[model samples]
Target: MACKVQKRVSLRRRLHILRFLTNSNYNKLKVALENVKREYENLIATRRDYIRLLDNNVNDNKDVKIVKISEGTFMVKVTCEKGGGKLVAILEAFEEICVNVEEAKVSCENEFSMEAIIVSEDQSLDVTYVTEVILKAIEK
Candidate 1:
């Protein structure tokens, strides 16, 4: 009878130990799961912000729209998100490219827009070549 009681007590102690270990493992898994969840949330928030900036067309800086007004005259339109360097470079683009500035209008603000009517100073002014030079200056 005493042997039976001892065996039962031993089995009960073993079962209690298994339950404790299981609970400890469960708690550790819960904490790890929580950490993963937090990291996932942070990643999602950062991605959302990036997508928002992309959607706003913030990457549309230094975009150019040009139209050939005549054989030696061309209309150049440039858009910039920030900085006055591009604006200053554009004024110098005509001199650098050896072209005449017929007319130019610039508005300095959040999204600056510059519209210019550029003409060739001499017969050397090629429409395609001058357009490329102006576009490159808009990048600066």
Candidate 2:
């Protein structure tokens, strides 16, 4: 009888240990999940702030939109009320700024509309500067 009782005690102890381990692992996973959620929220907030800054800088001009796609790449879109040699002028301006046109889609049938992927070696180039240069090209 004593042997049987000792065996029961051992089994009970093992069950308790398993339950404790399971609860510990559950707590750890919960904490990790919370940390990931916090990090995601922070990343989203940072992106929102960056977009707001870009909007403020480019809001004055409705004819042009310039967005930085990556470190040295920009996406530029321009729409003009008139179409002529504006496309050539814009290309020249891009050359003057040392920017290369990686890809572009342009329509100069009735009005001028262009979407271009531009890459630049100059790290200091920003949306405002590119916008100004394109605007000047459109005027000329």
Candidate 3:
């Protein structure tokens, strides 16, 4: 009985010390790697936003564009000749992607242009996918 208890205590102490030594260094490295990865992701997102800003209005005879302005925000620009109740459907599509409109403006100078600033809680939203969805909505 005495030998069993000593062995169990020795095993427990060894496990505790092993865990403490491994977790500190391992956890620190893991956290640093995660932080760097997030920063890289955000940097990629920023570059995409910059590129879109330059060529954002490329109509090419198409309507609707979802452009990411920053990490958690996007600008949705849509052109429609018929501007009665179509904005409602576009807004619905944006909401489906978990976005809230921060601001919206409509201007018509031979072409109706609707610009909306949208924000989302999700930081990893796929910019291209959302743009495609908005394009389909505008197409309809």
Quote each prediction's TM-score. 0.59, 0.54, 0.50
- Report the number of the highest-TM-score candidate: 1
Error of 3 at 102 (Å): 0.2
Task: Please identify model 2 stretches exceeding 4 Å from their true place.
Answer: 1-62
Q: Please report how far candidate 1 places residue 92 from its true position, in Å.
A: 0.9
Best by lDDT: 2
Model 3: per-residue Cα lDDT over 1-140, one tens digit each: 99999999999999999999899989999999999999999999999998887565543445767788899888888786655456777788887888889999977676667889989878888778777877767666
* Candidate 1 lDDT over residue span 35-137, tens digit each: 9999999999999999999867775655777777777787888776767477777778788767777898988776778888887767556666766776777
lDDT of each: 0.80, 0.89, 0.81
List the pairs of residues colliding in candidate 3. Answer: none
lDDT (10s digit) by residue, model 2, range 1-140? 99999999999999999999999999999999999999999999999999999776544333999999998799999987654588899999999999999999998675678999999999888999999999988887
Q: lDDT rank, highest first? A: 2, 3, 1
Candidate 1 vs candidate 3: the lDDT winner is: 3
Candidate RMSDs in order: 5.7, 14.5, 20.8
Clashing pairs in 2: none
